[model samples]
Target: MTPPAPNIDPLTTPLERERVLAAYQRACAALEAAQQPNGAWAGEVVWNPMLICQYVICSHIVGREIPEPRKQRIRLSLELQRKRDGGWGMHPDVPPAPGDHDHHPNHDRDPAGLAGAHDSWMFHTVLGYVALRLLGADPNEPLLQDVRAWIHAHGGPYGVPTWGRAWLALLGLYPWSELQPLLPELWLLGDDSPMHPRRLYCHMRLIYLGLSYLYGARTQADASPLVEAIRGELYPEGWDVSRFRATRDQIASTDLYEPIGQSLEWLFAGARALSRAIPAVVRRRALARAWEHIEFEFASTNWVCLSPVNGMLFCLAMWSRDRRDPRLAQALQGLEYWMWEDDSEGLRICGARSDIWDTSFALQALCEGPQIDEAARAVDRASAWLPRAQLRADILGGREHYRESARGGWGFANEHHPWPVSDCTAEALEALLHAEHRGWDHAAARLDLSDKLAAVEFVLLRQNDDGGFGSYEPRRGSMLLARFNPAEMYGNCMLEYSYTECTASCVRGLAVALEALGANMPSELRARVQAGVDAGVQFLLGSQASNGAWPGFWGVNYTYGTFFSVAGLLAAGLDGEHVAVRRAVRHLISAQRDDGGWGERYEGVLESRERPLDADQPSRIVQTAWALLTLQQAAPERGREAIERGLRFLLDQQQPDGTWPHDAAVGVFFNTAVLDYRLYKLVFPTWALSRWLSR
Candidate 1:
């Protein structure tokens, strides 16, 4: 007879078990209460102040004055985000000190001169300064003076990045000719062409669509006294159009994340030459083509377009073509969907919404714990809502528009946000499967056999030739496209490449669906699901770093990636003793803190694949939960002590309201900006503790 397996559930003491049970109950109550009446859970996605700045700039250019009350709130937001040195950084990591602008080391000197001085990138600083002025802050005020000094020290607005240049140019503060050409004719390229815009990543292409349209139309605001005054303030030395033209390619060291390569420069020069050579009629036709694509996207996404970045650009493009167009007003109104307001933080435009992502994770967390009656009712509602959220039909002319099949997939934000992502669909499917496993007959009825089959088909279609999955679409362009990436503040953004997080999510979802569907699954669909899982597993196994971590594309560093990787492997029938699983568990155990939790700095996303350990950072509640979940799934026996201690850390940190502290940035985008998803604090911790109780 085989030896009996050791007891993996490590809750030995009655006191410890009692504490965990009580914590679970409180957490369940808190999460259930936080759910929306529509049965979805969405938290504010806090990003940098650049979004607010863009809102201000867009309103000013479009000739719509922000209401006085709204401007006061926007002013408060700017003041709260200001650094001690009177500059704004990408995120609010460094607290501002009162009246300490002069003493801050980077106040007088060029902030770029100091190592790790990312607290004030020129991109945010210039935009923040201008946004404050637009909101009626006095230019001669002491705080504004300090901001001006900082800007002058950083080589003035001339050194800001391409996106900054575009915004300034729209307001007539910068010359359009000086900016790099975003040729609308690129839309005319055939789908077979490697350089086609369709070959670019979804977000990149959409943003470029709006940008090129505006650039083609030469959309600029009519000059006013405010524009002239702001221009003088921006260039204290003097405002010379020729001198500004010379600094077209210049970027401040503080704002440079991915330096513009020689290849990209050549591409820009060629684009300028093409712009000059193209026949007037052909150029007109290309602009028309671009507008058609833009209008399609605007309608498909329920007028929200993709994100605030493109949404504003699309509005400007529409306004430039026909100011009285009804669609323009609707587009502007739709933008309010991305706005988050608070009496304290004022109004902020988030990068994107997270309703589907948050709801899927929250449902999974609820399913892992003991089923209280209230929790069960919440699960039923969420499960019902999720199936309804799935896209039931592909968009018309999806192939013509360079879109993948979204028929059975879920998007990151909601059903109205119709850009389906691989991981979002997978996580949503897994959440429904978990509900089905819990014997929720109502959920099963809502998500019938055909619906599940369509979802599996959607996931199966997202797998790349390399066996991994990209976010929105399959990899469409070469990795060499990185050499031509024009976005100065981001990296690896040119094409949709495969990511570990997306692959792992697909694998786990397919495997769980396969097991749950049992013999009810059709033979053909079952084989395709198995093939996708096997391919996805191979991709995961080969992608592990030498240090046993996987790099995350959408979240912070190794901790987030490793959790999904380990969980996916286990769901695919890999045992804890497998070399890959064992190495991953060892890595997590080694990285645990003295406080018995885990923390990963956002900078790890910028480091080499073998991210160095940052031992000095304080443990974060969300990352700690990720490590605990990974260990529980992959190494219960080996990670028992670490799990218990981590549990204690979480329990001690829980507030009287039953939620964990959201003190650190958890989500990341483009490997440069960090995001604070407020709901992450509730979902991941609740899941970890509940998993422990069930075991």
Candidate 2:
């Protein structure tokens, strides 16, 4: 039977709520300044609370201490996030929206509106409390008491999620056996074997690598006297190591969003039973093979490792491997990449980095910005350097990455990290298109980036039987790996799910790229684009639910998906009377709030065969921009007012410096819950104003 979750205390002193609000506001202002031309901040650029935290962290990084007003704002934000029990959520805009599918009863909505209800997730719990703690609440406060109690009840040190366990293992807090095997051994499987971790999504593979190494060595952390004491406090009963690993099937109900199927569960049971009998000689051979892949991962990422979960584990693994290992030492250099500081709280780890990813769009958004000359020198620098970032060759043992064809391109930062993300490339291209059209003084001289569009040629080759594209590359793996998904901090983030925004980005980018190539796009490539556009249009049309929204895979939620997807479809010619366009426009219109803007919950990004979680903010700057863009695409008939209202919302939210207050996350794609998108406010709003006042 599942255990009861920690009950977030319902009672709150009004004074406490006000304190949180002050911190939250201060954080928002600091993050607003971090935008690099485009909308993204720096790392894990996602929607909702991720964005909220960016503002908070940025506030602390710049402010001597969080200003009093800012601390109060942040504190209030956290206080309201307190559910009936002691746990916290990723966002305040989540939770309790009945009509919103994100809050649907059937799905594992946090009724409180959190996704990782996944109580097994120590990362969120630790970080969630850390956020509140930073906001000035006492760590020993009752709210944290419930959280600490919850973590302990779940198995405390032993009971954390695999990802969280990996982190604790890094700190030498938990032994690896309490975890299942993620050894490099899986990488030895036949190419066709779907079970291989190497074949898993990049984010998952990186995270698993860290888990595998630490688990392989059976490392255990040294417990402090307080930790030993708290262990008793967390679990009423003493910790039993053997019993913890035996409950492999044990999962919190909230975390069972995707339960392991009987087929896999039975298969795993059989594998475990067989491993016991494997000859020591054979086991030695397996370990050797596993080490080869481990070395490869280390080499590929320059030891920065993949994402944070894996990065953290890799940090521990390297440290254990050797105290002074260069890679391990370097790996620790970017710890701040994931950690955010706020006045209310000092610092906490964040999900991932946004360095190159955000800049790709930021550059483009700057291209589309009203003050195109604001960053003219920076634009020239970016334009000249962009062509240099393209992928002209494959990486070491590259194809095993299942990279498929290496066409089109990605601009999440530039070509060095080019993994061929469809939307990142498409969005980058659109931004470039904007710049090219703007005819900057150097536009003609620097027009050479045009030839680099050959990457789009690669994208045309990866289109699916359905005519849509997946992020990073073609969708080649199965959903079966989702069951092995070890990240309790997020669900199904280990594999590619069909994304409307990603597909749309590819569509629009391809169209723009083809136009730029002029006659260079061969008949074969043009035919592919034609097929992609036609199929994409149908898929999008078919995708519009009765409620009229398309959920996003890479960003905040539905409003995001609807805008990017509809923009792609209409741009590809499905506008005017197209039934799909009309329905989508109808949905956006229906959602338009009295404020003359639209808002959605980040929860809308989730798709439960059971239900969905909606992002719960009204009139977000990003959503409003997306809605305005869609209206222009599908309903120019609505005139400028539709666009006008959205622009006004963006303008209204804009700080005196011309940046908008972040209201939601503006990123989404294959993996990683996001943060950053500092430029979403600037770029999208700028685009909206330009479009509304079109010549």
Top-scoring candidate (lDDT): 1
Give the per-residue lDDT of model 2 (tens digit) for 316-405.
555555655655545655343444555533234445444555555555544443333334555555555454545555556756554455
CA RMSD per model (angstroms):
3.8, 11.5
What lDDT does candidate 1 reach at residue 240?
90
lDDT of 1 by residue, 267-298 (tens): 89988888888898987898899989888888
Worst 10 residues of 2 by lDDT: 1-10
Instruction: Give the Å shift of residue 279 in candidate 2.
Output: 3.3
RMSD (Cα, Å) of model 2: 11.5
lDDT of 2: 0.54
Which pairs clash (backbone N, Cα, C closer than 3 Å) in model 1?
none
Give the Cα error of residue 659 in candidate 2, in Å. Answer: 2.3
Candidate models: Cα lDDT each: 0.83, 0.54
Scored by Cα lDDT, where does model 1 land? 0.83
Q: RMSD of candidate 1 to the true fold?
A: 3.8
